[model samples]
Structure formats: structure tokens, C-alpha cells
Target: MASCIQIEGLLQSYIDEEASVSERLLIEEHLKSCGACSERLALNRATAATLFEVWREDQLREDLTRRVMAHLPEMPPPTSVSAALRRQVVVEGQRTRRWLGAAARLMPVFTPVILIILAGLLWVAWPSYYNMGGDEVIGMVTYCDANPDATHYSQGQARRLHVRNPIMPDDHFETGEEERLMLSLAGPSHITLLGQAAVQVRAPRAIVVTRGDVFFDVFRDNRRFQVHTPDGTITALGTSFQVSASKAGTVVTVVKGEVLVDNETSFVRLHENAQTAFTATERPTVRQGIDTSPYLRTARAVRPDPDAERRFLTQFIRNATHTPAPTEQVFVVNTERRHVNALLLKWMPDPYTSGHAGYTVYVSDSAMAPVFKTTISPEIFQDKQNNMVRLEMPNDMRRHDTHVLHITVMSDQSSGPVETTFTEVAAIGEAS
Candidate 1:
């Protein structure tokens, strides 16, 4: 090989500590004869020795630290038991240090994973917390008149108002005036709205406000299934009732079934005839009321008749199912002639049993009654067909002029009566 190539190979072999004894002797002889080769060999050896010395110094320092700590003045004497303990401590500490170093090295890789876990927890725990700037109120409206159908109203007018549905945030009513406003809603039962009251409504609970003046009835559809008033939170399951607040505190009346009232301190069960009132404050005084007789009485007196509802449903179903009049004038009623045509009537399917189908017919002026009578059924009808009585007006009917022709229909099961009225009078020269 060329001189330069030979020198390069020798230098690499020396660096790798791979030269055989004969090879090392040959390299030494070549170096002694060549000044350049000698200088290169010395330089390489010096570099390698400096590197090895640094590594040795680090090992010595670590050993010295361990030995010195083992011999510290504060250390207990090295009895056989103590020596064993010291060795164990040193081994465990070294293992712990290795684990700590591994953890530190992995910190950059794990940082995003830790942050993602934290973010997921926050999202699941409180969804609303993220929407800190969104408006919470579902709707707001002003009512100025007792009239329920007023489409428009002037501001500040003494009007009866309503808020149909609301999200009912804990911080909704901020003002005392807003709290005093009374609202009522009709669920399967009635509900009384409470003004700014601090109450806790628990789950699986229902509430009733027997009576105390407070305004606002949050309809049952509102998100507030439970109510928190000054007295306490009333929790319920599928209940319709009212809650009232006053100097006496808050009273819950159940319009329907039972509800459980649990203040942070105690719990109580309230039934239809029972009510529970809680006073405000941390150490609240709670009172129970019986004889919900007044509440029951009020509910029955004001509640809409369910029978009327049945009738309403039955009437519509009958009109749609039965055949309709073929012509625009298929059924006609002439008050002047005291005649009615195409009148329909229904009786019980079983003649022996008194079942009422209903009466739908074009009535003449004579058929209209000043006093709406409930008892007149088949006897008042003048026409009869196939064991079925046909409803009609009395031919002699007169005193009741400007007659009204009406079609009345009723349901089989106590559905209240529903009627459509039409005036019988015709314009001058108009056909009757």
C-alpha cells in the first residue's frame, strides 16, 4: 500500500484498540523512522488519553459521592442490620432515579396527551361553562291587559303578561321586582311561579303552591322541572301544582300526586292533602300544613271540564266519518216555514240501554231554544225512522224568531256537547 494509505489504516486500528502485538510493533517501528508518522501517533494517543481521563473522573466522582454519603456523620453505625438496610436503600434509590430520568425524557411526548385528557374532563363535567358569553334567557314578553288575546299593548300598562317557556337559569331573576311578578302555567296540573327565591329543587320530586301571592307560572314544558324558592327546593315527578312565597316562607301544594321535599338538612314527603313550608336561611324552620281541602276545592272549581273535552273530540270524529251532504244545500232550514231538512240523530246501539250518539241537523228557527235544555232527548223530536228518532223543530215554533240553526254533536263517553250555530234569517228578496 501507499505510505499515506498505510498510515491511515494504522491510525484507525490504533483508535479501535484492534492492533495485534506484531502489528503494533511494526507501526511503532514505522513511526520512529518517520517524523510525520511519529507526530500523528503522539497526537492521537494524547487525545484518547484525555477522553478516557474525563470518563474516569466522572465515575470516581459518583463513587465518592456514594461513599461519602454512606459515611456521613449523621449516619447510624454500620451494624449488620444497618448495613443491609443501607444497601437496599442505595439500590432502590438508584432504581427510582432511573425511572425519574425516563419520565423526564418522556415529558415532551406526554404533554399533549395530558392536556387532551384535562380538556375532555372539563367538557363532560360542565357543558354550559364553555358558553360563557351566550344569552341564557329563552324569551321575554310583556303583558298589559287581562285579555289573553291582546296582540298589542302600550308599555307600563297594567296588563296580564306571560312568559311561555324559559331555560330557568339559577341566575335568572336578579331583581326584587322581577321576583314579585306572578305567573301561572297549566301542566297536567297547575303550577305557580316563584319570584327571586333561594330554593333547591331535587330530582324525582314534585311541588305544589297551595297559596301565597307570587307571580309567574312557568309552564310545565320549561326546563325547570323542579322549583327553588326562598323556602326550599321542591322536587317532583310528573306533577302539576303551585308554590307560594310570603312572610310565612314558601308553601308547596301538590295539585296531583306526591312530592319529596329535601332541604340540605332534612327531607319530608308531601301528599295531595299535605304541604310543607320552609323559612329562609341556613338554619331554616320548616312547617307542615294539612287540610289541603282548600287547595283541592280551588283546583276543582277552576279546572276546565274534562267532559266537554270528550264531546269536542267525539263531534269532530263523527262529522268526518259519517257521509256528508251531497249538495251545498243538501240540508236546509227555513225559519219562516218552520221546516228543517236532512237532520241526523243517534241513540244507543242497544235500544234497551240509554246510549246517546248525538244530533247533527239543519234546524229551523223554531228549534232554537232560549233556555238551553239538557234533558230534552227523543221526546222533543217529531220525526221517527227505523227505531231511530230524527231531530226536528216543532212546526208551531214561532215566539223564537230570528232563528238560529245549529248542529249539536256529543260523544259516547261523556264528551261534552259541541255545536255550530247559523242564523236562519234571509236577506230581503233572498230565498229562504
Candidate 2:
């Protein structure tokens, strides 16, 4: 590695906006990892601000910066000069020569220029996803059910992400706590990203999961698909896996195929239904027979919630706690593995027949009106096998839309009348 002194001239050129693109890149990358260099840049900025204060009111920063920096008094071009010296002279001759000499002296070479250039070459040759900097479109957001929590930062703009947003090598992608995003890599494979995560596309096939969890569904054809994290690098092919990363460490779980993890000090290979984790300074510890279903079961297709989420969470909590619950939902929208001819609703209260009378069923594909309505008798509901009621979905409904079903459980109580509405949603072709 080149020392700080070796690249000092390159750094000065960067500040002056006189460096080549490659040189500026080298210094910028260096500044990211070197605190001393970063501090030097800060101090340089402070000095420049002070210098600007002394300039005339009419002098622009650019004008002052471009002003001749040579301290020597100007001298006239001479008719007689050695051929070697004359090489530095242009048509303007000695005046240009003196300026050239002064500029060279002002920007003295602290170290050999060749050495700084060699460092630049090494940086270019270094193996990293960021080395390939470009605006070339690498992928696109295939599915983004984004709320305000989701953002896609590209070039210099940050905005809400949407389907069809082109991804560049340097683009930054982040999601809010409950957001979900998907990226199609212009190939057969794609990436399903969970929320509260930050990601940067290093290459078309490589990504850096800076924080939070991410799922990769990669194809074997995209041979070198890899993910980088604070702790290590994970490489896989023809695999489905999840990576949870933080500054503390990383955890990798393999769903179907194998993955290789390197934590700087060592490497570990994890196969199907296996997992491994490690810190920055420790070797990965592998665990076998791990259940990967939880990671793979993330819901990618989401339908809009119609305020029934309160009931959903209530039911979810009751189920999680092993509380005694009814055999059937008050109302439900079920998923059938294939297209169905009939819409089924199973309603079973804790007691087989708790209602004082019958309940009204209302089904609709829109709020404007119910497509079907009927009074379901509690006696018939209980006597029937499974208390299952079937409704014919509207044939005119959109192929991709879902039907909403809600029922008001009516009972004549001491208060004269009592009613509780149980709501459910059903998708046309979803699996049970």
C-alpha cells in the first residue's frame, strides 16, 4: 500500500479540481478509510475559507484559485535559450516557461509521480464491486409496494422507489421498517429485500448489505453472485439464501443450495437447511438442520388491507399464545391452491350456536354495493358439516382483484340489539 505522502500531490490536485478522473477517485476512496487524510481535507477546507476572506469583494473563488500561483516576478522571453530549455516554451516562449516552472514548483512532487500512479493502477486492479463505477443500468425494481419508508437513491437524487426504477451500480436502496422491495437483475434470478435494510449494487451480480436482512434468489447462470457485509463476503450460485447483517456481525442461512462465507480470517461452506454466523474477528460457526422456512416465507404479494388488520393481529396474537380459539373464523378470506369455482366461508363460534338468531352476510368486490347478501340461520349453520357457506364470485370481476367478505353477527341482547362485524378477504387464485 502507498503511504499518505505518496498520494499527497494527487490529493492537492483533487482539491484544486485539476486531477484526472482516476486520480480523484483514488483520493476519494482513500479518504473514506483514512481518518488522517479526512482530517487533512477538513483542515485544508478551513485554510481555503480563511484565504478567501482576504480576497477582493469582486474576486470569485474560481478566479482566485486559477490566478497564477508563481511567486517569481515575470521576466521577458529571451531569444537565446538551450534546446532542452526551449522545449518547455510554446509560441509565448519564456513567459510561459517561467509560469510552467513556477506552477511546477508550487505543486512540488512530495513523492515520485510514478509511485502515485502505481497506487492508482493498483486501486483499479483491486477486486471490489465498487471498482466498476458507472451509470449503466444493471437492474430494475420489479416489485415495490413502497410506502414513505422506501427510497431509491441514484446519481444525486433520492426519491420514492417505484416499479421500473432503473438501478445503477452506485445506486443506494433502503426500506422502512415494514417495507418490501424486489429487484430483477435483467436475468432469470432476482432479489427480494426486506425492510429496515440498506443496500448498494456493487455490480450486476454483487451487492453490499450494509445493514438489516436481505434474501437472494439467484440463478446459476449468474455465476459470481456475491453479497458483501461488514463482517465478510458471501458467494453463491443457483441458491436461495438470507443474510442478516449489522456492524456487530452477520448470519447466513441457506434454503436450497450451497453458499461459501469468508469472514476475513477463514471460510465456511453451508449447504441446504444449514446456517452459519460469525463476527469480524471470529471464524464462522455452522449449524445444521436449521429451519429456513421462516426466511423464505416472507410474503412478496400483498393486497391492500381494508382496516381488518386489527382483527388479523388479534387472531394472530390469540393463535401465538395457545389460547382457546374457535375452530373457524367469524369471517375469512382463504387462499386456494388453484382457481376455485366457489367461495367458501366457515363460521364457527366457540359454542356451536351462540347467536340469538341469524346473521346477515354481505359480500362485495367494491364498497358501492354487495354482490350477494343473505340471512344465514344459526341452526342450519351449526347443523351443516363444518358450517361452511359457499358464495359464487361475480363473473364480471377483474381477474387480478380480490373479493372482500364481511358478516355482521347479529344477536338480540339485553341492550336490545348487539352486532359484531367479522371481515375477511379472499384472492382468486392463491394457494391454501
Candidate 3:
């Protein structure tokens, strides 16, 4: 025999007097020792009894309604209209009783199911109910390079934000002049910091940009992705846009999707390829279909490293060399790279040049064409016999970004083949 302790379903059958003799005896004996089971049985019995009483009362009411109709017919067969109306009333009452009987039978089965569904709904809506603006990590630094360049302030000290670093609410991301930071948000939203920018993630789904050019590509979401600026706020449901902030004001350019730009006075909805500008105290001036190509091109462009660019320029100049080239060459720039661009020294050794001939060193930033030309006489050589040349570049090196040096031998002696060798080995800087 199955144990009564494990037979919760059997209680219903036992209360209905439908259990076998042996099962009833087992339950009776089990209830004597188990207070919880006895209480549950009593509650079930009381509920059953209550439902039975309600059903009996309804049946009695239904029977009395039928008896009253039968007695009224015996008293008088009324007019045709009255008799037909009475018949309709009796039919409707019978239908109502049938419906109520079915409903009462099904209520017990669906009551628990309805409660479970309601509980699930509440659980799903819990966040919205409490307005959980907690510092939960919604996303991480998906692509962050230039270590110690892009940083976030934490506990009075600035910490570097590297790849895979989790981003929390109120987390501030500030980049140096040369650094750019990329972040991914919860809605699969992407933010690309192109230049020197300072941004802090506000609670939930918003970011405040204080400076620099920031590109945002937010995927579709129920919650809006907000970009808070000094001038106004740009909110989007699903869009790719650019926000360029400066001292003058902020300019919002819509690249693909639509966005709403709100300021102190009013709000304007901007569509694709539309642009708008706003000042700190004023509302945004809307422009429609006004080509956003400039911002679009910039958003798609990658920032080249200054050091790598300098090296490429050096190699281009060094490629135009004949046999027995100058074995020694040096190029050096100041260490203060981000804030300043200065070429401190550039020394190239030419061993075969004539001592009496004047030399010309052509310089350019792109190495495509010479923008500057410096003529050096043989008497100016630091080492005369060795044909060593230390020609001072055009004084505009500090003003411009001088990368490549093209030294063409301006031999006043005998211009045999126009000797040219811009030998660039390694440029070492002085104490910076």
C-alpha cells in the first residue's frame, strides 16, 4: 500500500468517501500523528463543504424558479405575449445556471495557474517597478588600446580602461589628446571617441559628453539611448549619430537613423543626413538633408599613429638610394609628442659629396614633394674631410610636422648624376 504521507491527492478521494477501506484506515492512522497533514485535510474538507453548500443553494434556487413557473401556468394560461415572455425568462435562467456550474467546476483547476502567471509577470517587471538605476555593469570596453592613455577616475585615482573592462554606471572615460576610446553598451550600442574626449556614463541608459567628437551607434531598444551635452540632449531608439562638442556649442549629425534633439525651449526631430547645431543657452537650429558626408567620412576613418607615420615617411625618402649609400643616418623628434610636435635633430652622413659644392636638402611632411629647401655650403660641414653634413632644417620645422628629408646634392663642382641619398637609420632624441 502507498504511504498516506506521500498521498496528497488521495486526500480528495478520501474526503469524497471514495478511498478503499485499507486506504481510509491508513489515512486515519497517519492523520493522528501528522498535524500538518491533518490541518490540510481539514482545510480541504471545509473548502469542499463550502463549495457543496454553494452548489446546493444554487440548485435549490434553480428548482424553486422552475416550480414557480409550473405553479403560475396552473393558476392561469395568460395572454400569448405574456406566456412567451415568461418562457424566454425561464430559458435564460436555465442557461445562466449551466454556465455558472461549468465555471465553478473549472475555477479550482485554473486558480493556481493564474496565480503563477501573475507572479511571473511581476518578476519580469520588477526592474521597471523599482526604477533600478543601480550601478550594474551593462557593458564593457570592447576595444581600448593605448594603455594609460584612456582612463577613468576611480577612488581619487585615475585608472586605465583597457579591453574587456566592465563599464558601470557613473563611470567616467577621459582620453588624452592623442588617444581614442571605444565602448559597448548594454543595448549593443557602440561609442567611438575620435579625439580628446571626456564622457561619463549616467545611470541606466545615458551618457554625458562634455567634450570632443563622439560617435554613437545604438541598436533598437525599448529604452532610449541618450547623449547629454552642454547644449542639449539627443535621444534615439535605434540610430547611428555623431555628436561633436566644443566651447562654442554641440553639433549633432544624423548618419543613418532618426533622433530627437531637445534643448531648453523646444525639441526637434532630425532624420538621416540631417544636421543640427545648438549653443549652451539656445535651442538647436535644425537643418534638413544637408549632406552629413564630412562627419560620416570621419566616423569611418581610422586615426593613424604619429610614430608609425613618421617611420613610413623616413622609409620613403630612404628608398631612392644607389650602391655605396651613406651607412649613417639619424632622425629624432621631441618626446612631448601628444601636446607638441617638434623635430629636435636630423643628421645624415654623405661621404662622397664634394667639399666645395653647395648642398640642398629638400624637406616635406608627406614626402611626396619638397615644401622646404635648405642650401648648405661645404664650409658648413661639421666634419669637412669626412663629408659629414649637419644642415639646419628650414626654421619652420617646429611650425609644421616635418617627417621626411630629401637631400639632393647641389654639386657646383660637376653634377655627374645628381647624387641623392636621404639615409635614415634611427633618430635618437636629446634629454626631453
Candidate 4:
């Protein structure tokens, strides 16, 4: 015979049908004599049954609501409430009763027809609603180590890949020891993956680095390219950069061009030959002259065509300097001490410009009084293809102040000086 406390412990298991046969028999025998235990078991069963009944009723109500909504006809707005009230008391009441009775009689027949119509509508609209298109092959594996074990995830399934495998968006890659992989992507971007690295192609313009080191030789384009690390996100401004991740922090190295490194609290811009480090809980630290010789060697070996760079630059310039400059372009000036306050100015040359001489940037106070000026050399824009220049604020003038920049571009074919004025506002806040 089982004691009441023992039977109490086994009661739930017995009710759930998980008790051993001997234990079940023992509990059954005890329940026959123990009123309290028997009542508890009965109460538990009754509660469960009531809950199931309520759930079933709720589900039925939901189905009926959906069907009723589908069958409802559109109604026009009421006109002349006094007239409507008089009509509703007489002719409308009879019509309403007849319609309700007829609807009740036809519900069974209408259900299947309504379901079929809905299914057809869903079938017709499914693709556009979900945007389920074939995955884009953005890149192909150019190199792999001997029998290197790399896996790619697609459509919620993981598959192993060999050399020459096509990389698609949302395709995650995990490499093993002694493994080296190279990817040639659409932007003429060359990515080199070292061993023990994990990365995902989040989109055509974005890559997420989970661990290890990867080098990027991103060809300059108008697209916003980003690399997300655990510590921060690095945004490319037409640059070749490298991201290295570890348990301690993530390191970003800019070999050429520029990049913006941002964490939750602050952001810092890195130029050529610059580097920065970020940790999840700490502010980003800028470092001087990182050694990128090893990655630079790899980038040079797989360098893209010189013409591609020129085309990208030309397209960017055309887009940035369209006919009749837009009046609403706003450039925010950063007041954070760690960030460089600069404005990027670009312009298109006249139709017959053979060569550009240079540019002169003049900074003036709010009253239009000249405060600072500098002349930029044509060599700065040479081979870049893009007629763009950056006007940086002198260190002394970077304090909380409003300034105006007057830019004049000199080219051989220009009939007159090409000039534009920009307002720079120093907003007070931490850099984002």
C-alpha cells in the first residue's frame, strides 16, 4: 500500500500515463481508499478537460469570424438618418430578417467556395507578398586549401563547398585549420579568408565577421559597403580594409582610402595607413600606422583592372554632381574630439575640360569674413578619376562654431570658375 504523500507525488505521473505499471497499480489502490487523493486527481482531469473545451471553442470562433468577414458585403454610408430610421422600422426590418435567414441556410455551401477563392488569391499573390526569388550568386571561390573543410548555409540547410563554389547572400562560411580561401565578388572585391575564420555574406553590400581575420580589396563604388563585427561596424568609403576578430576585440586596418568605425557609443574615421580597435564595452581606440604589408601583397596579386576603378570613379562623380546641384544637401559637422570634421565636395568638369589645375577651399565665418584658406593640388585628384576633394577644418576652428565653405574648381576647359557654397553646422553630441 502506498502512503498518501507517496501517492501524491506519483499522482501527476499517473494522470500523465507515465508511471510504471506497479506504481500505477499502487496509486490506483490507494486512490480507491483516499478521498483527498482521488478528489485531486479528478479535479486535475476536470480542469484539463475544461481547458481543452475552451480552446476548441476559441478555435471555432476564430474560423467563424474569418468566414463571416470574407462573406460580408460592402455597405454604403447612411443617408438622412430620419428617413433611414423610418425605413428601417418598416421595409428594412423584413429585408434584414430575410437576408439573415438566407445567409444561415447557405453557410455550408458558401464555406468551400470562399475557401477556394481565398486559396486562389493566395496562390496568385504569394510570390510578391513573400518576395521569394532565387538567391543571387555574388561571388565565387577562387582558391581553397587541399581538402579544406568549408560549409555554407542556404535556405536553412548547411552544405559543404569545394573550390569554385558560388557564394550567395546569407551564405555562412566556416573554415578549418591550415585552410585558406579566396573569393572574387561582383564589385571586383577580393576577399581572402584565413584559417579558423567564420564569416557570412549578409547581403551584396554587407559582410558580417564572426571570428578570425579577413582581408578586403573593395573597388570604389556608390554602394554603401559595411563589415559588421561583434564589437562594431566598419563602413567603407571607397577603401581597401582588413578586419580581424578575436575574443578580446576587433581590429580594423585601412590600407587605402577611408573607413568609418562605429560602436554603439561613438564612431571614428580612419584614413589610409590608419588603424583602430574596438571592444564591446569600451570606446574605439585609434592606432597609428598598422602593418598591412602581408594583406597588401595579397591584394596586389588579385588587383582588379585599372579601367574598372576609373569607371566606378566616373560614375560616382556623375551621380554626385548632377545638373544643377540640389539645394537640400545637408552635411553634418562632428564635434567629437576623436572624429575628423571634414566636408566631401565633388563636382563635374565642363564638357571640354582637358585637365584640372587644382581647387581652392575658403572657410569664412557666419558674416562671410574670410578666416582660413587652402589650395589643393591637382595631383591629389590624379588617377582617382573622381573630381572630389575633402575640405577639413583646421584644428583650431573645429570648436562649436558655424562656418561657411566656398569652393572654386579650376580646369583647363572651364569658361569660368566652378564654385559652390556649403554651410557646416557643428552639432553638439557624441559621434555616431
Q: Which has the greatest lDDT?
A: 4
Q: Quote the positional error of residue 390 for candidate 1 in Å.
A: 28
The per-residue C-alpha lDDT of model 4 at residue 122 equals 87
Give the winner by TM-score: 1 or 2.
2
How many pairs of residues collide in each model?
Answer: 26, 2, 1, 0
Q: What tens-digit string does per-residue lDDT give for candidate 2 at 106-218? A: 66574467679999999987633234342365665656766733378887578567765556777788877888777655333457678878888867678989888788877
In candidate 4, the residue pairs with backbone N, CA or C atoms under 3 Å apart (3 or more residues apart, or in different chains) clash, namely none
User: Residue 425 in candidate 1 has what lDDT?
Assistant: 22
Tens digit per residue, CA lDDT, model 3, 1-432: 346557677899999999999878888878887778889999999999999988986574445776777767455755666777888989999999999999989999999999999999988866331333334655556455545643776434576656655566788888767667766565546687877788888753699999999988775557788999988899998677899888989999987778999888878899988989997668678888877656655554433233322222232222325222322222333223221222222222221122223445444444446545555554443232232344443444534443443334333422222122332322223344
Q: After superposition, how far is residue 250 of candidate 1 from its true place, in Å?
A: 1.8
What lDDT would candidate 1 get against the real structure?
0.42
Q: Which residue runs of candidate 1 sit more than 4 Å off their true CA positions? A: 1-189, 192-224, 280-289, 299-432
Of candidate 1, the 10-residue stretch with the lowest lDDT total is: 347-356
Give the top-scoring candidate (TM-score): 4
Considering only N, C-alpha and C atoms within 3 Å, which residue pairs clash in candidate 3? 331-427
Of the pair 3 and 4, which is ahead by lDDT? 4
- Note each model's CA RMSD in angstroms: 28.1, 35.9, 33.7, 29.0
Error of 3 at 7 (Å): 80
User: What lDDT does the true structure give each of the candidates?
Assistant: 0.42, 0.62, 0.62, 0.63
lDDT of 1 at 401: 53
